[model samples]
Target: MEISTRRLKLLAILGYFLTGITGGVIIYGSEKMIVATKTPILIFMVWSGLVLVIVSLIGIYGVIKINFGYTVLSSFALVVVSITLINHLMYAIIKDRSEVESDRKVLKLWNRHMLMGRAMHKIQDRLDCCGIYGFQDYILNDKQVPVSCVSEELVSYIYKQLGCKEASLREYLFSRNFIIFSEFTSLLLNMITAVAGFKLCSRIDRGI
Candidate 1:
């Protein structure tokens, strides 16, 4: 069986629509991460994601309505957002690559944002980790490691483990990479549908 051009165009449009929705959800959903960390970098990332999400929704609406002008504008916006997402993701990956540096960064964030410190303590209790790099992080910062780092098995005993920086960094990088991948995929999907829309609009212009 062969698919008609119209059918293919419809399929592409649906794909783009779904991709936009997915990207929007991911981008908007990152608010939780931002609240947990409350770092300037995170604020910027979430802001970018929010912008991408809004643009994606615009594209989705335009494609669904088959509006040539709206589709053209939204596709252009998507291209710019995709490039920005990729660039920020790359910069974050590089900045977060080192555990020691990540720990230092986290400490600075915690100092500037008291809420971040509380969140870090909560994370330590849940993950059974110490400070960012270890107990030494607390010492260097002139703060004592929270009791949350103590093992349940030996509450009375002080047990020190690897700092939460490694795990936090790992989770952060994974989220960044996921966003990057999603944005890249969304870009391709938008391109495909945008091209189809352009061709369709051209045909209408030619009265074919």
Candidate 2:
């Protein structure tokens, strides 16, 4: 019984550590990516991390105190984490699909006038890309190719060869895919942790 209790405590501690690391990674990754501010997936991921961190803390405390109630609470928290992850995953997929479809319309708006033109220029500068499709887009639109399209070395041969649309899409897709992968991985881990938490609760309830 003593050995079982010791193992349970250790498992709780491990859960706390793993959840902490996972939460930190997700938050950090979101910050580093160029995703839109306060995006749904981003907000959901932040909240998910916070909730998991709290859940892990509860698990640790419950194990330390051998409290059946706290143990059960933590298990419920893990269930919450699982549900949120699944919700966010589905939302992210739908959002990605919709965004891809709307990219052209968004780009057209961005190319409409001087104000949006400046915004597009900033994107071009940041991504080191040219117009929608290439430098030829500027010619087609009767606009001058901005300096943002040029490389630092001003290599004439490759000038304005890359397109802002492609670059931005690539970055967006990469960020979305990364977040999706993280959520899926976290969901799996949460399931395992929840199972372990339930087992631990049973042992504590039996006065093991």
Candidate 3:
């Protein structure tokens, strides 16, 4: 069975488009879970996703134009993104998970961003939690426990027992691990498609 140059190009373009779409959806879905949790490592996931999408678009354009230069650029970008993503995943996997759940770290992160504060408020409200550690940790400027800390239900229940630190930590670790796996798989596929496309373009240019 023989494949034509045009068919190869089309397949390559499809690969890039599908990979890009998949990545966008994955990031969007994970954003809600990670939104409340602020950390330096999370920023790379956002930036790398954007870069992958851009490079995927470039790859599609290159396939359409039959331009090897564009294909090479896309391939190079994919390699860089793949390496960075792998490293990020390694760090996430190898790092001390307990340290990431520190009360002080969570509190500092909550204070760093107003958006994070809003996110945490929403999370706490939904989870019926008080603060990072407990109600005592919520004291600020003589302010009482936030409304979220109190259970809305009149029935007896332990609302204050659920702390944001543990909830956030669970969500963060789950989301991070999932993102790492997804991106790593997509990166490998995208790199293969990119390299194949580049070579096909070269062969076509040389009239092989």
TM-score of each: 0.66, 0.78, 0.78
Which sections of candidate 3 miss by over 4 Å? 1-3, 96-102, 109-123, 126-128, 134-143, 152-155, 158-160
Give the least accurate 10-residue stretch of model 3, judged by summed lDDT: 112-121
Output the TM-score of candidate 3. 0.78
Once fitted onto the true fold, the runs of candidate 2 whose alpha carbons sit more than 4 angstroms away are 1-3, 34-38, 90-109, 153-160
Residue 196 deviation, candidate 2, in Å? 1.4
Point out the worst 10-residue segment of candidate 1 by lDDT: 33-42
List the pairs of residues colliding in candidate 1. Answer: none
lDDT of 3 at 12: 86
| Clash count (model 3, backbone only) | 0
Cα RMSD (Å) per model? 4.7, 3.4, 4.1
Residue pairs whose backbone atoms clash in candidate 2: none
Q: Write the per-residue lDDT of candidate 1 for residues 1-208, one digit (tens) a residue.
A: 7555577457646755665575666556566655443345556656665665565566556656666666667656656665676676677666655455456656664565344456466666544667766767777876666677666785555755667777567656655665556656656665666565556555434544
Model 2 CA lDDT for position 14:
82
Instruction: Give the range where candidate 2 is weakest over 10 consecutive residues by summed lDDT.
Output: 32-41
Stretches off by above 4 angstroms in model 1 are 1-5, 35-45, 89-101, 109-128, 135-145, 150-160
